[model samples]
Target: MRHEHEPKQRKHTVRNVILTVILVLLVSVGAYAARKYYNIKHAVDNTYQSAGIKKNRNANAVIQAKSPISILIMGTDTGALGRSYKGRTDTMMLITLNPKKDKTTITSIPRDTGVTIPGYESESPSKINAAYAFGSSGTAIKTVQEMLNVPIDFYAVMNMGGMEKVVNAVGGVTITPTLSFSYDGYTFTKGQSAKMNGKKALAYSRMRYSDPDGDYGRQTRQREVIMAIMSKAGSISSLLNKDFLDSVSSQMKTDLTFSDLSAIAQNYLGARKSVSQTHLQGTGQTVNGQSMELMAKSELQRVTNLNRKNLGLDHATTGNIALSVSDASSSSDSSVQSANVNAGN
Candidate 1:
């Protein structure tokens, strides 16, 4: 009986020691993960603006809600001019993502589109890009929401100066030239696909004058470059690179917090698998000697419908939505005047 009791005690002692070791390992791993999470959160919090946006129609929706969302992408020309974080939105795009439908629609707006900016001097109309330079994030978001007649849930202001570095960091991107032309020492033939480095990609996306479609063609190229970058960035190899993430983190200013981005990547990135690009149709005219794109009322309505449909708001009537394309003057009526702004880059 003594020998049997001794064996049982020894076995119990060994089991307790093993349980203790396992508990210690679990605690160590949990601590490491929490530390890493907080470190990333701190870095992203310091990178950009975290202020809550005002007047967002979908402000109630959380990232985990899986609801359809709209984002305004503004590409700024700030990094080169040695200016503050503000500058003209040289490229503007309104993107709608539906995770349920797994679809993404990106509509590129022309930079020179005449739109009234809030807080602008003299109450005169100006290019849509001016919204960023003069009004900052709040003003820019308001200006676009008024123009597109859609609730913009998020806005990202990207500095174009770091675009070259981002491209280089991702190795490079491949694009199919829509037309045969030579620019910035690189010769591209029509219908030929080419792999472009950072400098070449910038030049390719920037060359609008030589294309037959002018700004429209440039918009197409810009979309292509963006898709290419997105494609490369999603690769396993690119995700593993710490340096690439650091490079992009410093260049972007946005209202979306780090958790918001993480939730989007986790849930909605699959929508990127099928992407559709659209452009606003309008005629170019010189207003006060400055070139501006004048979109017709019918075209504006059509664009509004398309964006609304994509946002799962098609059944919701936007009959009250109208753009002041005909009048460059600021209106006294808040409803009529509130809708004035550029959807362009």
Candidate 2:
């Protein structure tokens, strides 16, 4: 039941922080749920989605053998938050978990980064996020693997909207902003700590234009809230909410089985250490008329090397990757019709 004092926010309109929230909270919370295994298992089971791609390394074997592995965490702004159509992914993070070393890395891939969606239109570069729309998780995984030259062993996709409910379910989150700004009817000042409910948290994270670093600054605030929620979500009362569990499960689809989560809780507790994040930078260009972010080959190679090192794979330089356009004058953007890229970088 919602608090009568709380004002109602938009019905299905939260952002993608829930992707990381669900990915971690589900596993760590379950680790403490020895008394509620069946219930937790049932909820996780409701989120089963098979990737069906042949892996270079088997996920189960790697986990059972206590080896390192990588996962792609994706969140689509679709099927909820008033987005009824099949939507593209706005949030994509390449995650590597090393249980042997107690370290984890999250590399953010911009939604508008230009890449060829393998099976979709195989002709030219489209934003990396469109890979999900062209084909679901499978194509997205294939595109990321081909471009970055990394093996994705597991993945999870969720409607970004559940974040609001998640925040409220944890009795709301507290945050301190580094800058003061107003967006969507809420305001916060730099260096001031205040408790934020779901709606305010969403507004706080979604404001990028006012930030000095734009989207990267937005990501930092998102991380702050994610850490806040992760810290608060460990309580039994928070995870045992039947209504929250049902709603979250219905919105998520993942290749991780309940057993996989259980194994993670058992063998990979070390991965719960402080997360290190890297952002793959991209420059905007008119790609076939649409504004797309293009990453340089050197940057891709840098990201690839880190992911490979974390996964214990032999380092190999990335090739066949999309390179950024340098000559801006060559773009016939005014002449060519742009592709629909409603989601911005």
Candidate 3:
């Protein structure tokens, strides 16, 4: 009877050990899965093609290398319900990332600002936003380059739906109202801190009719949302979530490569924190029976000076190139004049 009892006790001990080992293995697997999920979640595909813009092969020659890279952040009204890819960019901002100074300058160009397209000649003075519809991203880049007299290094295009998804992914962003205004069935009170989700944030940035500053005020709100999004994105929680990355990538298109993103993530993450906002000073005028924002030559020169100085580019005079206009006979520039400047995070 004693021998039989001993055998049973040994058997029970053995069973306990086996169960413990299995539990440990399961825990290890879970940890690994979590790590992998985080890595992949923050990892985004490089969608930027370096074709039209000037390429700097020596961009990453050394640590703390000061390379001035310009990116076009485009927000399109495409991919929304009942919308298609043929939509033009509704918001565009030129972001100059200066890694050396750990500083960034964002220049907001009102979409209604008239500009000449580089390759086209039929239109002498056309709305700035028309460049995207006429020639896609490439043409838009060229048009901006001509308009601003600056080099564009990359382009990131985000659909309207993607903007909402990004806002939702970060939970939400807080925006301070500049003035009390209502449009698109939404009302924003002055001097209030509004917690905005994707839809409401979209409405917040899109409402321009009731704004006292008009497009400029709307653009300021857009920049506010952008800065809010960037702040949320920089958090460790966002960097570790794979679901958020997949959502953002699916909703947006870009020319930034994966390696470029990683380098930016590792090297220029500080620059995002130190950003200065810029707006082109312009006035509204009726051109060809349509209201347009006309940027004065002095205003353009000021933006060019600011962008060039921020990027550490060769300090050249802003009036070297002739302004080229896009062909307006094919498409009305008024349809494309909806571009506004917002945040680029």
Candidate 4:
């Protein structure tokens, strides 16, 4: 009986020790998370504002409310060349997040899309991308609002140079090149799947002229790299890497508070699983010696309706005024744009 009792006592002691170790680990992890949150919040505070524009109606809103939101992601050329913050916006994407439907829609606006920037007072309509070159990101945000008739809830600006740092930090990303091209001594074969580091990804996104579909092809590649980054950044290993975290803090600027980001990550990140990507449509032509992508007013209205519908906003506000435009004449551009709209995760 004593031998049997001794064995039972030893088993109970081992079980208790294991449970104690697990509880210690859980407590340590919780403490580490709290410290990390505080440090990040401190680092992200006091970023630049959009100068002189009204932010979306989410001033008093919380992510827990689960309302639809729109964010503008702009790739600025300033940081690459060590210039001032005033630089041309080469890439712009509008993202609509709908928590109710668990879907995200990302729409790319062509850099050359012709539109009149409000308060710009130019002699004639200029390329939409020039809004940033003329008046910084504030002007760009206001111009996008005026053109699309959609409220932008948030805006994030990333320097082109930062792309390389971010990609390299993630140990590179895998992408399939749609068109074969060489730029800056880097060669990309058509329809080839390859892992790309910072330099290659930058070249991949910057080679517009070499692409059969031109700027539209560039947009598709940009979106692909972005999605790959998102995938990598979602991993615990990537998130825990000090270099990656430092790169993100140094390279990206946004209007989102740390609390806002945390809440979105907690509640709305799942919507990314059903993302739909699309690009604004237009016909490229030269007007007054200036090249432009003239988007039909009808096309703009169509995109506006799509975004509004996804945001759970009332559709009655978008009128059918611009209804008499023709289809895009660039077949390659249209095909690339169409294929990306339903790109799967």
> Best-fitting candidate, measured by TM-score?
2
Which pairs of residues collide in model 4? none
Sort every candidate by TM-score, greatest first: 2, 4, 1, 3
Per-residue lDDT over 1-345 for candidate 1, one digit per residue giving the tens place of the 0 to 100 score: 011123433333322221111111111222234435554454456455742447567543744688888878777754642355466887787878788888766676777776666566343366677677666777777777777788888777667666687789888999888788888888888898999999899888778789988876775576567667756765444533446555555676667666666666567755554465666676776554456787777666666787888788854433222224455333333332333332222
**Candidate 1: where is the Cα deviation over 4 Å?**
1-43, 50-53, 58-64, 78-82, 121-123, 174-176, 191-195, 230-234, 270-274, 314-345
The estimated TM-scores of all candidates read 0.74, 0.83, 0.72, 0.76
Q: What TM-score number comes out for model 1?
A: 0.74
Each candidate's lDDT (Cα)?
0.62, 0.70, 0.59, 0.62
Q: Tell me the number of clashing residue pairs for each predicted model.
A: 1, 1, 11, 0
Best by lDDT: 2
For residues 1-345, write the lDDT of model 4, one tens digit per residue.
011123433333322221111111112222236546544454455333444566657543835587888878787644553365456777787878788898777677888776656675432256677777767677788778777888888777767767788789888999878677889778888788989999989888787787777877776576567667756765444554556655655665667665566566656655654556567777777543445787776667777887888888876443221112232222223332332222210
- Higher-ranked by TM-score: 3 or 4: 4
lDDT of 2 by residue, 1-345 (tens): 121122212110111233344554355345555676666777788888887678767889887888887878887644562343647887788888889888776788887787766775433467787777666788889989988899998888777666676677778899889899999899899999999998888778777779987756776676677667766865556565566566577777888887787777677756655355667887877766666778888888988998898888898978464646763335443222234443332
lDDT of 3 by residue, 1-345 (tens): 011123433333322221111111111222335555434424344233443544333333422353667777776765642244346666787877777787767676777776656665454355666666666678888777777778777776666556677789889988888788776677889899989999888888777677777776666566566667766765445544666655556666566655455556556545644556666666666554445566656667888888888778767556422222222224354332332111100
Better of 1 and 3 by lDDT: 1
In the predicted model 2, the residue pairs found to clash are 12-81
